[model samples]
Target: MEFRYDKEADANYVRLRHEQYAYREEINTERRIDYAADRKPIGVELLCASEGVDLRNLPEQDAISDLLSQHHIKVLAS
Candidate 1:
């Protein structure tokens, strides 16, 4: 998983490549739970703006924080 901000393009995106499914069942179950909970899960990549809104001038960390804050979403990781 990687987080990057493109200054020229003024876009912020997150890239997560799953090399292998270590716990396929667990992952699937979690996905189901999310759906059942009626939560619209958002990935980092979806945050990118394709309209050429460059956000790269700002600090990457700050930009990410702002996005989550605006969405009222809390990032939780184990």
Candidate 2:
């Protein structure tokens, strides 16, 4: 997958387009998990090189690590 940063928007987003049914199914599963969670999730766009990239493939911790490494952003462990 590929990642791109949008300087003007001050954000990084991943784009994925699905042309297969399996990919659609995977996305549905992720949506269900997100909905079932007790805490609300903040939606952020991501950039991906693969079509139909699943957000589930993007782990929260990994993203946090990337944020910290790329932008020197810190996350206080709670």
Candidate 3:
């Protein structure tokens, strides 16, 4: 998994797989879910960065941290 942030777009993306995305859906405001061709979830996109995701209440923050703990992932924030 990977986390990418775009300062210009103020967007954040959590990539769960390196596979190409087949479809995307806006689950709600400023949030989109990406799926692979086989319907497997590939990742999630958070638009407007801070407005889209609250670090204090991130639903998957713990899960992501746990995954990152298994690997050497460099975190960046602005």
Query: Which candidate leads in TM-score?
Result: 3
lDDT of 1 by residue, 1-78 (tens): 345555565444543343332221113212211111223222233222433232232234355555544544343321
Local distance difference test values of all predictions, in order: 0.35, 0.35, 0.65
Model 3 off-target regions past 4 Å?
A: 52-61, 65-78
Off by over 4 Å in 1: 18-43, 46-78
Model 1 clashing residue pairs (backbone): 10-53, 10-54, 10-55
Stretches > 4 Å off in candidate 2: 14-60, 63-78
Which of the two, 1 or 3, has more TM-score? 3
Model 1 residue 36 lDDT score: 18
Measured by lDDT, the strongest candidate is: 3
Worst 10 residues of 2 by lDDT: 17-26
Measured against the true structure, the TM-scores of the candidates, in listed sequence, are 0.26, 0.29, 0.66
Cα lDDT of model 3 by residue, 5-78, tens digit:
77798777788878988998776676688889988778877777644353332336566555544543332321
